[model samples]
Target chain A: MAEVRLTTPISEEEIRKLKAGDTLYLSGKMFLARDEAHLRAIEMFDEGKELPFDFKGLAVFHCGPIVKQDDTGQWHVVAAGPTTSSRMEIFQDEFIERFRVSVVIGKGGMFERTTAAMKKYGCVYAAFTGGAAVLAADGIKKVEGVEWLDLGTPEALWIFEADNFGPLTIAIDSHGNNLFKDIADIAEKNRPKAYEIIGASKE
Target chain B: MEFAPIIEKVAFNLMKYSATVLPDNAIKAIKTAYEKEKSTTGKAQLGAIIKNFESGAEKSTPMCQDTGIHIYYVEIGADCPIDDLGKFREALTNASRKTTTEVPMRPNAVDPFGSNSGDNTGRYIPWINWEIVSGDKIKITAFPKGGGSENMSTVKMLKPGVGLTGVMKEVVDWMISAGGQPCPPTVVGVAIGGGADIAIKIAKKQLMRPIGEPHPQKEVAEMEQKLLKAINTTGIGPMGLGGNITSLAVHMDYAMRHPASLPMAIAVQCWAARQSAAEISADGKVKYLHHDIKD
Candidate 1:
């Protein structure tokens, strides 16, 4: 796995090289958004209206973080951990295609539709640790801006510049491989033996 | 003496405590998992989660942004003095507001049709399960269950002949399909041999067991270990990023069942499995009972 640093304006090619199991240390600008923002984006797109920001080559993080302000009025992320990505599965493909998003950062693996979208659109789905919000916050160099305050802090869009932002692994690669499904398959194969053990123990 | 009011108070308190205590377990488990994790990325992720929990606790913040829905399982003593159960409900509703402000749990309860209850308590804000026991002390266990994990729970009824093999197949299959979706690595709770509702209750109760603690029954203990090993072989690993530790534990609770009906339930507890217990005595004394809480 190659360790590459990403900046605000990344290329689809940069994302295509990533595969399931590859790791990345992302840098530069990234946007935070979740269920609400996704719905809003979809609405705007369907209405054929202009979006608040450009979406091409952008990275969207599936997170609703708990942030705190320190003594200096500087905001520190208390828990900026990733949310479950599969919940976004329904909208992910359309979101990627319409927005030209290169990387989708979140926890958990995306579904088949998302993996297919990744391969077709030259994108990748990378997973940061689900519960590791504090470490994720440490990757942020600055908070560039914010928007959509009506959704509240957790649901609002916060723009941040991060340095070496991840040890994130590719859960869905450009080749359409999904780590989540593969693991499930392995677990299924050994299930019978597993039952026998449990049965024997009961005796 | 009515019992409803006291039951309500107990339910409310359970919800509050469940939300507040999640970070401790999440941090502890992540740190331990990191040290033992075989995969490099998994180790790194575990380390990050540990740091997050530390900061969340140190700052007195909720470990996760999703404070989750309030769910409580309560056992009331037969001899306990409770004049009004409705008062208990009122107390729970009132306590929910206090806990929301104190623990600062995210206001998650909403009216099904519309409208948000900013205080986190509303009609049925804290879901309650009640049981009457013979003792003079009331015990309450609270689980601040996240939607993600709750969505992954599964229930099935097998023919008696299908036996333990059927149970293992169904449980492991569900977990595999749930990989990373329920936020692996997770702790799985299995309840077998009870009626549908009771099976579900037992499954959730199994989650209260401490991580790595073996079940008291030798057979159950072996099943737990076998399932754990089988799940890890999936390579779903930590955080679904792929690793050796897919599950930290598998706990099960069983019950006697009908001759022909073998019902089972699997409740998935995310890595952030937060639970705490409390007991109230006849004299109105209260005690916090939890795995980590010390006197």
Candidate 2:
């Protein structure tokens, strides 16, 4: 219920102290990477190819932003909301284990394997509200750098400097608590009630 | 009269408006959700969503990063001055390309195996559905479907015996299973009684309606109300973090079906619910129907 301020390079101790329902406003550095970038980063790590940026203690955002360049050719984030994190579930556990990222910022929330990884690695999944792109971009003070433009604009990795970048709800904490899963469990219990209300049965 | 230029301009404007501005009703629904949300997490999510759209309108930026794949529903007049329908298609395509740069929409069209088109256009991209109707004007609605919600859309063929109860149960079960993936506080469009493809198409089309607008038929409206209540009861809430209000509304439509088939489709529109419309007269005057566009 408390609003916490997190600045990267966030520490494992700091992330461990956070709880599942707390609100967080993050500042400092965060990297935007979605599906393609996630795969590429992991592949690069496995292949012993050094990635351009070190993810240590930084927030990994699940976002494919709408960025534009001015006449001066400096890229500006037009919209930068989080993409669905569940899509990254396959690589997230490994991404966390290999990259040492402290915070995973995204929408929707990740599932069991990623939650287990967060528990083991002291990482937290903080969910920015889905579709809050302009607000997210507003917090991004500058585009520090970009990589893999060949993957197309949306799939490229954008390095951003952020200031008070969220009202992120910690949906999964380092303590094995998962808000999304809890809600799903509740929905499962209520499913029969919904069916009863509709005078129907799933079968 | 040359209609291509007018159509191009109108389509471009609609795409821009939809990307940058949340429709009035969608904003209203989110406000209501914010007020009614009991959980702190859900409330914060709703509050952020409200601020995002407000900021987007002020700065003229996209409300979400995924500006979405362009989909248009066109109602053309039989007596319209436009002689060539192919030109109309070309104009819409051109409009999509223009909006990509001008609104600076994210280039969302990507080939499954290859790469992004970078222009929000490609083979069968900017998919348009046409209906020939009875006026000298064409009404176009731009409904850009984002990847997250679009991925959650489904079509299922239930046995005819399951009937309305089956449809209701199926929807509730699916939403519960979908969890936060489609972006909760979604506007769910449920279509029944058509073939599999028609059901899916109709289901998506139903999303063009404003949030919480009831279907005109008494029985259909009742169905919507019941489904809405049932969906909210799940406590999936905003962004599926938990609370009341999993969905803003459940819009349902149906068609006559073959006796042996009972097909249903679920189309979800995320909280952004970006859509806009404009009517182009034969004389080329653009009338904005959905939002008040300031020139």
Specify the highest-DockQ model's number. Answer: 2
| Cα deviation of A142, candidate 2, in Å | 0.7
Q: Per-residue CA lDDT of candidate 2, range B16-122, in tens?
A: 99999888898898899889899877887788788778888998888898899999989998888886677988888999999888899999999998999999999
| Candidate 2: regions farther than 4 A off | none
| Residue pairs with backbone overlap in model 2 | none
Model 2, span A99-163: residue lDDT tens: 99999999887899999999999999999888888888878999998999999998999999999
Compute each candidate's TM-score over C-alphas: 0.84, 0.97
lDDT per residue as tens, model 1, B33-56: 777789876677666666666666
Lowest-sum lDDT 10-residue window in model 1 chain A: A194-203
DockQ class, candidate 2: high
C-alpha lDDT values of all predictions: 0.74, 0.90
